[model samples]
Target: MATTVRRAVLTLPAAPLGPENPLPPLAAPGDVHRPAVPRARDGEELPPAMARRMTWAPLRSLLPVRRRDAYGRHRQRTDLDALVVENDRLRATVLPGLGGRVHSLFHKPSGRELLYSNPVFQPAGFALNGAWFSGGIEWNIGATGHTTLSVAPLHAARVPAPDGGEMLRLWEWERLRDLPFQVDLWLPDGSDFLYVGVRVRNPHHHTAPVYWWSNTAVPEAPGSRVLAPATGAFHFGYERALRRVPVPVWDGADRTYPLNGQRPADYFYDLPDGERRWIASLDAHGHGLAQTSTDLLTGRKLFLWGSGPSGRRWQEWLTEPGTGGYAEIQAGLAPTQLEHVPLHPGGEFAWLEAYGPLAADPARVHGEDWAAACAEAAGRLEAALPRATVDAAYAAWRPYADHEPKETLAAGSGWGALEVERGRLELPGTPFAEGTLGEEQRPWRELLRHGVLREEGPEPGPSLVSAPWRELLESAGPGPYTAYHLGVAQWHAGDRSQAVRSWEQALRYGCAWPALRCLGAADRLDGHPERAADRYAAAVAEARHARVAHPTATALAREAVEALLEAGRAEEADALLAGVHPTARSHGRFRLLRARVLLARGDAAAARAVFDEGFDVDDLREGERALEDVWFAVAERLVAGDGPVTEEVRDRARAEHPLPVRYDFRMGA
Candidate 1:
């Protein structure tokens, strides 16, 4: 059959991605990764310059960190719009609205699903903003963490392909880095592989830091082995350190097997320079999925949620029960996901990736010798689909990349269009048309055209903190609303003192709760926790007096109560929590705060009872140990045995009271 591309609707049980938090994300949450000493790979010293570059331009803050925590466990069967690209030997399904993810890739001849297609649409607090789902191939672009666009849409259209067929192109402007990127997926006639071409363009006059990782989720079964063209890897676990270790075998076990480990971890394969970049996962029968990309996309990695209880629980939480487990084989632009490559002004990085079924001899593929196994898999991949062929395909797709869309398959956000209008960017291939602009961009568009931001709504809408937007906000005439937004932009730009000053100026003009909350955050960051608590309390009080029962008010209460508890003012925290609106008190996050307050007030039983009441924090962050840690703290208090809590007592509590499976979201052992 000839290659084809068409639109379709897929029905799945999906949890609603609720409305975003109204608060502007001033500072970023703590970096989840713990600082680990850099270990030499294969006994060779990592070049000093390269080491420094890897850590350069780490994200401090960015716009649109919207909290997607309002979703609940209730899921209703919903129809999602999707695009399918197929050929004689393979079929690829793409969800344009959901980050343009390759939702499914099936090997037709083998009758096997090459990717771990998720069965349900469950949004979790995994993305840099929030609301990320598992499975399929996720295009992770932007900073070190998952892209803020993980759950957002991408502009999708049908573009002419080199093989005279049509390729599905998904493009969007990534606001975090202020760059445009596109992913074009097509299947060639009579080919078993699905070819994907990705391009990230820096249209600005200055250089920008860029990160891209194509995360492909493949099924994981017992005896499954992941192979790559490397003998060693930079192993990073939830413990927060990247330590170089030997491939296949590490810490007395073959770590390549997903089931061999007991925690969530990342193994960034240290591929030698000039080596073909590829990663594959094969089952006991030696039949599985493989992904190979051009040299420009150089990194390859394996991520596994191991056989531990927490890992297993996470797997179950991400999908429906009885659904099999999966592991990720990722390819990126850097050696590891921790690094961001520099894209010079007007420079663009483009590469082609091919994913398909790979069959090798089981013995050699999972052989005891890691190098031999990798060589065997690499040889098979070369024989099946040569690297030269992928390169030629990329070359062929370059000209067609500029082809205008024959049909618009889906619509993404209006931020791209707003950026295009503001900068007058002439991107021929990926058009961010003026027609796509929506309400979110209206105020900013007015500010761009005129000189003032008309904050004309009950709540301040989304924020834009890009360099150009900041410059515009600065030039606009001064006012309370302008100062509030200007402070947000300043905070994102790392102008901490100026941001605080601007927020204070806004508060003096009677800009009540929002400015107070921002000042609270600044105080906390400046190491004045007591003053931070006071600011937060004042913010909450102002919101209460105004009778603002909006989500922003709820967010304020949560932040204030936590701050009060942190300042060891348990009575004040409890009083503030109790005075909040009933809806806010019933929220899962607020309930967690209530429990914390009770515990701080020396009421451990009350805190324990809160856990026993069976509440679920819909926006539980990935790798968050809050629930587990609190459970242990409560357990320690309960098991105090008439003595003050000590190290031995804590150990005894942990030993005597095993963490309930429902609350166990620990990322490490």
Candidate 2:
């Protein structure tokens, strides 16, 4: 019954995570929720402390957007590399190549899968950079959205555990925050619980905003209740507001059951200062999973996709149509996902989390009294796995945190190796060796070592915008290539004027259409939509004339059409879209754009027909309502005659043209 760690392969039907978008993510996709709460709402307001530390603004920068939208919906049987850590009582399956996600945790005695084990490896548009799938225990770091490493590989290795058994260690330098982090997972020789040790290190000389959330997905079932040690919670819904509401029941429904509401929502439980932080999801039979962590991880949240059509549709879209729904019970360093904790210079945050089964009294867990229900689950959790044991585990794991990895298991991005080489980082156990550096880091290495950025290909492969990289780019002499990168760095640093100047200079120096597209993004951000459209159109024309790759041409055309439509030039948008490659025309994104143009040009029938044709944007983002909005907009135009469509017309359109399930990917109420 000894613990063992070994490498294995998981063959699932997986959609290939296509190449990263070559374009610099000059503009954020603008999908994050920055909820603005009202001062007066029946004596409800965000706690003053929560409101003050809510944003990581002035420090948060998303400069190098490595777009992962190139993945298509076609999933083939694929062999995913994995690492398995198992003991007598439980087995943990980790996907080393996929952000070090814990793909499955199986309890041997009960023959139960504690985590929501996704049946397939489908990449959806959920991550901050794109391409995210539902289910599993996902480690989210680097700002408010899903981590940029959602589907990216992480360096995995075998390390010695405190228990004398080998532990699986996963480490990577988070690009967004420019910090190194590691996760060590081990199961003791004779334990039902799987232990995880997480550490995020800010090796920089200045303060860095650090966000970490261990998101666990559990199967959603009838009578399932999420129990936490808090009565009141901060509720955030699609209305884009955070309101303090009572737990268990709010807005005349018992929301802890996951299926009680008709919309997707988050309940960030307000845990007491000294309370043992833990959360559990118990099913109808009173048997379920519980997660507990050291005091360093304070936040607990319940994210549910309720029984509404939109929520159901989103659930189906994330996986197969007939799969059971799941809800996320998460723990983070901050009280809510909206906040980011500041890790001081040369500081680190570490914690230990344990996951296993808990069998509680069903009647008490489902009772009317919220306190009694929580106490019931909490008591059972304590009896099963005491808080002191978790603390001791953390203490034991800390010393081994710096132990050199015994054997390499997988490879991650070489950005860390590049950073380590540039900065002379002395990290011990989590090494970013020079051998990990690849083609992506070549130009940066050249700039770092030789002081000049070399032109790699037709387009710049990626972007680096952190202050250090910016300093390096700034030091690199002024050329078309250097200027383009400097523009991106300047833009991320909030130097809009200088960024624009640099981009313009790059274009003048014969830089490719990337500069023009970046300029287009800047114009849109500066509130000149028409100017943005012009820049985008110009970029598209230049790309075609230059005989750029068909994908690049299509990408440029997509941006142009979007900007043109946003500028209220539907005819121009349609004309521009029509001239793109046939693959672009058939793309789900373009089809939706065409529908928008048809509605704008006063052709509701044509717009509706596009919906009937049925297309899927493989990378349709989480919480994106563009498709649903357009469908209803076209419906309103079809139902309402001439003048402005009033509320009455809107209601009629909703009733008459109910959103088709195929297109209902709305994440809100």
Q: For each candidate, what is the lDDT?
A: 0.86, 0.87
lDDT of 2 by residue, 1-669 (tens): 656899899999888787777677776555445565433145565666666667455233455657787888778999989999999999999998899999999999999999999998888888888889888999999888689899999999999999999899999999888999999999988888999999999989999888899999999988999999998888887767777888878889998999997899889999999999999999998889999999999999999999998898888877887899999999999898888788999999999999999999999999998899999999999998899999998999999999999899999989999989988999988999899999888988999989998875567678888888899888887789899999999998889999999999999988868899999988987899999998998888878777877667777787788899889999999899889778758879888988999998999999899989889877788778888789889989988867689999999999999987788777775
Off by over 4 Å in 2: 29-31, 38-45, 58-61, 640-648
Please report how far candidate 1 places residue 467 from its true position, in Å.
Answer: 2.3
Model 1 poorest 10 in a row by lDDT: 33-42
Best by lDDT: 2
Estimated TM-score for each candidate: 0.96, 0.96
The true-structure Cα RMSD of candidate 1 reads 2.0
